[model samples]
Target: MAMFVHLTSAANAPRIRRSGIRAVGHGQGGARGVYCFPVLPSYTHTHQWLRELARFGSRGGLVAVHMRLDDTQEVLVGRYSDRARGAQSIVSASEAVRRIAALEDPRGWEVFVPRAIRPREVHRVRTAPQVAGWRYLPDAHGVRPCTCDGCRVRGGYGSRRLRERLPHPLDGPPPPVKVLLARVEAGDPGDPVALREALHWFGMRRRGPLSRLSRLAHHPDPGVREALVWAVGRWSTPGVAELLDGLAGDPDPDVREAVEVVRDPE
Candidate 1:
């Protein structure tokens, strides 16, 4: 699922382009498509740009607007299988506008990126050197972090199963479990897929049987803490109660609620 911003009018291009790009939840169904544009890289720039994007969406003008979150759920890598690719280069916003507007099917997934949109790969090279930590992510295919929309959206540790019993007499989390935990524990906090799946593993007691992840209860992201709350019941040890006690004071209401609901579902 690549990001596609439909220029409402030719005039909106320059203003929208000033807002830098980042992917959050969005889709094209309700005009909620991702609207990342060419802009200077700075924290303040993103903060201001988001305001502009939302403002344009309100008036329903040529400026960047919102899209349905559901439509942009799946992020895919490489050329999309079903949708046709946009032109190699669209010289002017007018041409891009004409081409997309002239499309045989305006409701399709095709996107027209007008200029050199820097790839996400550039950030990884500069910020994160190769480390053993990345091995846990589901994308075993390659080393570099995949920027494909599909790859981005693929979360939850790949399995929903509660647990898989160990085969040998030795008592240690199998390598696979270790990797899953690594992915959940060390993964991008913004993406919580693996963290969710890892919680399920813990909920099944495979976590205790294999290993314990004490740090999970204190994960900085509230989403991870909530998942841990739901899984606390599965800790076959006395620590479950203590963990729940600690979580009762959690800052996020959602996390506290998960603890309460999971503790006493009746």
Candidate 2:
């Protein structure tokens, strides 16, 4: 009765369940459930489907993925869309698998535990980042940290649409840019996870304001600062080199090193 959306190559869903992997895969995906839908997950309309799996008639929904390798991999399961940008397809399933695997190999993807849903829900769909409680961490060593790629392609084509020059990543009936910006501006300095997510949203924006980057450049946490550098590089903006040049003097060695690598990629 659940929908098992398999985003990666192969993982032997039965083995995953027999071992009692505990709702680790996205939407409990990859399992050859009573009902399963195999589709390559993307940041586009995929997010809407993830939330309303039951609406799609699956008892629950799951998107099993791995970060990069197709070897023996684990995937980003049920994980919710980005709080700020919703969900965009950026990081590949394998990319996420490798990142999580790094934290706790094989069971690395277990880090993202989604809300449990039953088969008979008649109304209301669900999404991730429940305002508070637990959160997903985007590792420092990630290529495109989050798996949402739709936004990475600049919402549609180019970075952003000219008519809709909004701060938030392109979303239907989008939230006010100010509100999205506030999430970053007012994020907890001590929580690198929160700050990095904010920086990520800004970088993902096609028409995002550049000031957001500078404002968070000297964030209290070095990890957040490092994230800021990554966001800049990821966004591929106009004066990226100039901006990174300024960050050369950043106090954190990691931040400076990131600038160097991003400035001249091999």
Candidate 3:
């Protein structure tokens, strides 16, 4: 068997011990599965996901669920960053274990099992140190992070502190929906950067009159068209759905991709 460790909220320990870990995906691409690290010989490396998982764990303290899989079981493996971008490869469980174990530094490697781990496959569930691993990424301690609107999370833990320390060019509280609407309505149609920034604010606020952004649905710039999809997709106002449906088959691949993400923002 190839051993694996899954870090999850401790509040889920009881249910996990009873029914095993359910498959769920995170990040933009929405690849649903059970994410885990192969149980390496180094104890610290084996539990490397503790801290990162805790940031998103709403149930408080976390627990490590040690599990096992048949050596030949197929699973997806890739760099932690690659998984978010939908880049990964299918390999046998033993192969994944062997590959990571051979790496002198396997800090960012991740494995995903597409199905639920059966109760029998769960070896043990134990509480994990809440601060055992890195946040953002490994060796990212002193690096200055990008504070751009797209790079920074709005309501993430410690986000306020980060914003105070490293303000972005476009950083600040979001403006009223009406103000954003005026920016879009009065802004230059040909300047994609300005148009997209206005649309980005609309998406962040997740509110606005859909008709205000209707003109950009067929914008010449792909980025502007993509921004339009994101901004309008966040609203549930009538007509918004119909407008998105129209862009569902946009000529630009990026615009079409944005439509898929907006429609299935899991």
lDDT against the true structure, per candidate, is: 0.41, 0.42, 0.78
In terms of lDDT, the poorest run of 10 residues in model 2 is 31-40
> How would you encode candidate 2's per-residue C-alpha lDDT over 73-140 as one tens digit per residue?
23333234332233322343455433433442221122222322232311222232112211123232
Q: Which candidate achieves the best TM-score against the true structure?
A: 3
lDDT of 3 by residue, 1-266 (tens): 99999887777788888988776555326645688899887888888877766554336577888999999998898887787667888899999999999998988789988787899999999877786777668897899886666556656778778877876767555667777767777755657887888787777654567776788987789899998888878676789888989899899987887787666432
List candidate 3 segments past 4 Å from native.
26-30, 84-86, 148-158, 164-173, 177-266
Worst 10 residues of 3 by lDDT: 23-32
What is candidate 1's lDDT per residue for 1-266, written digit by digit as tens? 22233223334334434553323222232222233322213223212233323322222333333221223233321112232342233234333334444444332223333222233311211111111111223234466433221232222342222112322222223346566666665744535667777675555442363225557676788888888876665455667778888888999988886776555331
Candidate 3: which pairs clash? none
How far residue 175's Cα lies from its native spot in candidate 1, in Å, is: 9.1
**Models sorted by TM-score, best on top:** 3, 2, 1
Candidate with the larger lDDT of 1 and 3: 3
lDDT of 1 at 264: 39
Q: Identify the runs in model 1 with alpha carbons over 4 angstroms from their true place.
A: 1-175, 187-191, 206-211
- Candidate 1: global Cα-lDDT? 0.41
**Candidate 2: residue 171 lDDT (0-100):** 34
